[model samples]
Target: MKALVLAGGSGTRLRPITHTSAKQLVPVANKPVLFYGLEAIAEAGIHDVGIVVGETHAEIEAAVGDGSRFGLRVTYLRQEAPLGLAHAVLIARDYLGEDDFVMYLGDNFIVGGISDLVSSFEQDRPTARIMLTRVADPAQFGVAELDRNGRVVGLEEKPEVPKSDLALVGVFLFTAAAHEAVVELKPSWRGELEITDALQWLIDEGHRVEATVISGYWKDTGNVTDMLEANRLVLESVESRLDGEVDAASDLIGRVVVEEGASVTRSRIVGPVIVGAGTRVSNSYVGPFTSIGANCAIIDSEVEYSIILPKASISGARRIEASLIGHYAEVTPAPDTPKAHRLVLGDHSKVQISS
Candidate 1:
């Protein structure tokens, strides 16, 4: 079996950050969300992989070059535009030729890997297999309706009134039969070919379309909140390690990882927290679920439950939590004049001013 990883698409939801970087490349616990997917694919024993990339192709390629590092031989399939999932399938027809493959969404985070799902598909040989999870907002995702006997009966794409809460997770397994369905699919009302439509067509033709309802954690890390949540989830599994220098005045509480070359002086850190390589935290409080990236500086500030990307710095700030700081960004105290709120926010960015 092979793998097709979709790393393309304009992540408008994570704007400002996505404006400069691919959403899949955004770090969760200092690791790219896409890298987790790649590792999962490798763990599934699928070495022949095809990555679908779009405008941010250069960035993705630079990070995942040759795929040898991940135990896979990768061939990139370029999509001209951010069409749709079905469109991605259509473009990857050549690379995925006649092979049963798994399509993994780069921005999605599944707690447990898809090894069991792949094994099941290999044994049963279903025409297509989709991962489903009960979501609160099924209307926002492609949903599935199952019969009483646990059979997938229908599929819907962002329904106004969803028939079920079984939202489609971002992992899919498909035989070569899915190619014809994708080729025959028409554009949806949103001017894009929908994968749900292709799966529906498979059902109509009496081909076995199986559904695996995942009970484990599944999150589509498309927005800042989801990203931070994913970072926290991954950090939960991080073991305690202290390779870096910590002053006697500093207090380390709980499971914290201070990478080599990192320094914490006269500060307090509550984990699950990680101070990346060459990072320095002085006279500050790095609270739980916070990931301070490489070469960052945190002084006289208090930050918690946030992701600080590489080269970012925070100083003299009272507190920051549940935030996603981008690369090379700085979070310092604003000028003491005027006591007014100042924010330059991106589209879809949310801020709750606690004044």
Candidate 2:
């Protein structure tokens, strides 16, 4: 089977950051979110992969070139616009050809991988198979309605009143039969061809649409809260490895990974935390679930549950929690004499002030 990975959405939700960097490229634990999906696809033993890319195609290509590094031969398919999932399939018709394939949303993070899902699809050979998980806000995702017998009976895209709380996960398995349904779809109210509509079309045409309700962790990683949660979840599995230099005055606690060339001096790091290569943590308290990217500087500050991008620096800040700092950004305390708040924020920026 082949794979189709969608890396092409303009992440408006993660604005400012997404304005400069692709949302899929956002680091969770110092690794890009899209890389996790690629690794999962490779683990599923699908080597022939097609990546659907949009305006940020150049960056995606640069990050994942040739795909050989990930044990797959990737072919980049250009999507001229931010259409819809069904539209992506429509454009990838040539690349997908007649082969059965899996469609993975690059921004989605799923624990336990998709190996079992691929194996099940290969054995059952359903016309289409969708992964579903119970979500608190069903209206924010494409939801499915199951019959009394637990069969998929209806599907809707971001319904005002969802029929069920079972939201569609980003992973999908489909046979060549899905192509016919995709071509016949009309634009939804949002002016894009919805994948849920195509699946409903397949169901109406008497094709078997299988649904699996997954119990494992699944997150979209589209917003800050979800990204931080995903980072925390992934950090839980990290093992303690200290290759970098740690001073005698510093204390390294459970499950911390200090990459080579990183240095910790007179600081307290409470894991699960990762200090990326060439980073320095001095006279600071690096708390749990925090990822400091390469070449960053953390001094005289207290940080917890945050992601610091590469080249970012935080010094003399009393407390930093549940935050996402961008690349090359700096965080410092305001002058006591002025006692004023100064922020040079971008569009769609949301800041919370604590007095």
Candidate 2: how many backbone clashes? Answer: 0
lDDT per residue (tens digit) for residues 304-337 in model 2: 9988888888777777888888887877665443
**lDDT accuracy of residue 168 in candidate 1:** 98
Candidate 1 residue 12 Cα shift, in angstroms, is 0.6
Model 2 TM = 0.95
- Tens-digit lDDT track of model 1 for 298-326: 98888899888888777777777787887
Q: Pick the candidate with the highest lDDT.
A: 2
- Cα deviation of 67 in candidate 2 (Å)? 0.8
- Distance from true location, Cα of 28 in model 2, Å: 1.1
What overall lDDT goes with each candidate model?
0.89, 0.91
